[model samples]
Target: MKIEVTHPEPKPGEPVGAQYWRSLDEYADRPEFKEWMHREFPQGASELDGVNRRHFLKIMAASFAVAGVGLTGCRRPESYILPFSKQPEGSIPGLPVYFSSSMPDGWDNLPLVVETHQHRPTHLEGNPLYQPYGSGLTAQASASVLDLYDPDRMTSSYRGTRRITSAQVRDLLQETADKFAPTRGQGLRFW
Candidate 1:
């Protein structure tokens, strides 16, 4: 058997050759040609004939499995919508609403205002009715909201050795006052 190769070039004033080989090197050096040869006649591993097909199929199957897993994982969680029992007169759901209130912390009772969205207080602003201490809500008032929400506040207000209610605290104050009332003229030391 014998094999021959040919090269062709376009002539002057003629349409350029759409496809032609310039040299045997051009055909042999092509990446697609090399890849096709590798797929058709792989060297040094005859067992790869069966393994390569199985490997290509396994890779494609795994790619589809990963794509399906990713799509199923992207599903969003379910959300529940609960309306307020008594919605405020001017408040609307999904809209920012402001309310005028006073922060009774002796630091300018400016109309402490807060912005609420969907019945949740999302932000706080200083009441302009009081003195303007620069811009938005003061650090103390902002921190007070965190303090109010803290679980430790109730635990910190207990009397030594005993947990007493507000009424019990008032009675204890009255008893201490009665004991001190009789000795008003005496110079007593607090220590």
Candidate 2:
């Protein structure tokens, strides 16, 4: 349905001036405008005097926790699970497992908990078990998922301008080891 809005024309001998509207509702008196006028906060921005920012955050957190509790009861759909004669020590076929792990951050290894689906690591969280530091995963830990699937990650070893396979690299290392065998204690390179 199209609603036509017509503005009042100036009286016979009056000079024309700019027309100002307080709001779209004031100009058209729409049903939407009536609804807005009836609300506690007419323009939708409520004055927070009795209810402040802290109280608002608490309410929001409580609501989210309640919703999460409700969702936890739901069951997943049927899927395939490979039967192993002897399953690996920590793995449970259907349930997601959490592993306490860490990543290098300067001098310290930042504590993290990895979430695994089946046998593959899916995401990272904070590890609460370690006594040295309390559990809290950094934003960088969460973003490590991108590195797992990075296309530019080094796949092959290279020597100078020559491309080499793992087998060739192993052979070259063996040759160097043979060359250094006779002088094991006499001379060594470090740094």
Task: Pick the TM-score winner.
Answer: 2
lDDT of 2 by residue, 1-191 (tens): 99999978978988787768798776898988778777847563875668888999999999999989989787897899569988888887789998877787666777888888876788887788776666776788779867866899767788887889999999987887888899873564422
RMSD, one per candidate, in order: 19.1, 18.1
lDDT of 1 at 40: 65
Clashing pairs in 2: none
Q: What's the lDDT for candidate 2? A: 0.79
Judging by lDDT against the true structure, name the best candidate. Answer: 2
**Prediction 2 TM-score vs. true:** 0.38
TM-score per candidate, in order? 0.35, 0.38
- Residue lDDT tens for model 1, 1-191: 78787656667788764768766756668887676567665554555554687798898999999998899678688999887788768887777988776576664454578777765665678866655554367677776656655786776346787788888888977877777889973654332
| lDDT for each candidate structure | 0.70, 0.79
